[model samples]
Target: MVEADARIRLYEPSDDKLVKFSIGKASMEGLAVANQSACFHPFTLSAWVALSCIMIQLLDWWPKPEYGLLGYLPPLPAFGCWGAVMLYLIDWFNRPQFEDASMDLLRRPDVADIAKHYQRSPSSGFFILEYSGKFVGLIAIDASKDSQSQDTLMDKKKLSSSLPAKKSQGTSSVATIRHFYIDEPYRKAGIQEDLLAHAVQHAFKADSAVKEIKATTTSLIAYSQKCIRDAGFALEKPLGKLGVYGWKLDLVVLRRAYWEKQAAGTVL
Candidate 1:
């Protein structure tokens, strides 16, 4: 449980080491989550079942009476069953997914410098949630390069504006939330939602031109949809199949006007 001392504060230079460690830890955790969340995509299961049936059908057809009621050969059916089991094991316990996911986290810039890319933009910042003296989790948001542009109506906004969108935000003064992770032990505390709320609330209030926020999460993360939904983000679209295992990236959006209209008093 998160202690009463738990609080979300601005990121400090001293926290860099722990933040890196957490990101690495999250890579391993992400792999575990990906492995367990396979149920979310049932097609994978159906395919495995179909393969097993095919293997059984082949075994029954290949064996002859002289071959001991097995395929034409004495040990052919045994070999077929063994081969099928091995394939299932190899597919189910794949390590490529973990390797790919880990390398990506290690490459992300924020795991170390906080919002270094922002170049100290006040409207953007990294936050760490601390329980007692230990860091429980962290979330960061960065404004697009067009952050300073004049406020304009949503209908009037155009991609041709002189300023390009921050890669994280990808157009206009939008702020993209990144590296939002909580240590496993502390997730049961329900503090994740509050941490997310503070980040979003701060982003909207920090700048007026920043009328919308975008976040890239994964279909592999089962709880992500509900958590971000509770925070006022709606699934805008699917990014695509991202890894070798066919996992997907989803884009979710939260509009400033919508955030202001939430009925939940506890939502920041």
Candidate 2:
């Protein structure tokens, strides 16, 4: 194992170069590849639609040959729509997802603005894991107040009914984990477990009102779910094909209580 002193710290604008390098490495590993479907993928479906429209426009304009209203009109709308759709699909596929959160972060044009967004409040912040003075991982947490956060909450309630009940006193503040990633070479070294533990501790410390930390991951990334579990979170239900997991601070307290009780009995 590569034994190096590792530390997790708040993100800084100066860390952009290390962050970008990490993203580039991930992209090369094909971790950012779009999910492919046997049946037409969404991008492929879009391309087909655009192509069909172009063909229809060509067929309509072919016989006319002259630069009249009909010939010009069909080509204009057809090519416009096709170009727009193609551009959209290109961007969509190119954008990284959860597995490559660091890449997604680096891709943003306004890194400073993004850094500010996460650091806007004590309850939210972005973090990077540095091992041996080299950044190797990153994770972020933010308050769940936006539309995406609301949607995730809704999914959790609807799908994770069977998950362990909250043992801690409930609060309105919910923190969502974002852009969690660890370098491949350094993984399986219990780094993720440590990172997650720190994340929860930081969340509780930063905002005492935060009672719960919520995370979601696709079934495809089994290691992510494992990391969450190793950090003392419980797997809830499946939200669509994604698995939902949560850690309640109250549960930690309860577990601690149980251990204390056992220790007291041993002393007696």
Candidate 3:
């Protein structure tokens, strides 16, 4: 009984020390909570293998001709557009959906609507950016075959140059980037730069003789402008209005520099 009483007394909380004892217990609880926190995702082995295959295929495309009708098709545009919608939803959940949001303010009604339309029409040339098996962003290219302005832009060099007649009449191999968006958290982690570097490298591997890859971005996209510039794309001109509504649509032209002075390359 005496030993039991002594042990009980030793373990008992005294009134005078109760506050300090509670604090110690709380500190331990806080540490326990912290230790239970989750970690950021890392890429898996299967993902790495899939990525390797994609890299091989992308590089292998360089030397071959882009087959007609199928070559330039943006795979699974519906899925890509939905992926973009998911990204926007993530953004909205984290931040306020401002009334003057760029999508709302621009020609598009809203980001979700724009994404839905693209999914249905499938011409926006959008692709999802997945990192560590998570959706990180979206990349889009403007490759509408009927875009006269883009066609004119691509053809301007050949039409205006005084180079050899054969070179002038040959192929006009070029492509334009239209949209690129990364989630806010993923913006500064060099993912954007890495993606572009990989993309450009893949393009080069596809065709050693392919010359250029260009893109246009609005000055309003300040963050994107910096990203594009950092990726070795240079600004060319301010884009004028889109249509006769005289609705002023201003954008900056960005071009990627490539040297392909070979005769085997054909333009799309």
The candidate that wins on lDDT is 1
Error of 3 at 28 (Å): 46
| Top candidate by TM-score | 1
lDDT for 74 (candidate 1): 46
Which ten residues in a row are the worst by lDDT in model 2?
Answer: 242-251
Query: Which candidate, 1 or 3, has the higher lDDT?
Result: 1
Ranked candidates (lDDT, high to low)? 1, 2, 3
- Candidate 2 per-residue lDDT over residues 93-143, each given as its tens digit: 544343344444454422424475565457676789998998779877664
The lowest-lDDT stretch of 10 consecutive residues in candidate 3 is 4-13
Q: What TM-score fits each model? A: 0.66, 0.50, 0.36
* Cα-lDDT of candidate 1: 0.66
**TM-score pick, better of 2 and 3:** 2
lDDT of 3 by residue, 47-109 (tens): 434554465465553222367666544433433444455445434442232222322223221
The local lDDT score (0 to 100) that residue 182 gets in candidate 1 is 83
Runs with alpha carbons beyond 4 Å of true place in candidate 3: 1-126, 142-172, 241-268
* Candidate 1 lDDT, 1-268, residue by residue in tens: 8546888898877887887777667656656565545433466556665665676576564445664544456445555565566445544664576666666655644443454654445567688998887788888777656443323333124543854444344334677776678876777767788889888888777767677888877755545556777777988898776443667778889987788778445455
Angstrom error of the Cα, residue 228, model 2: value is: 0.4
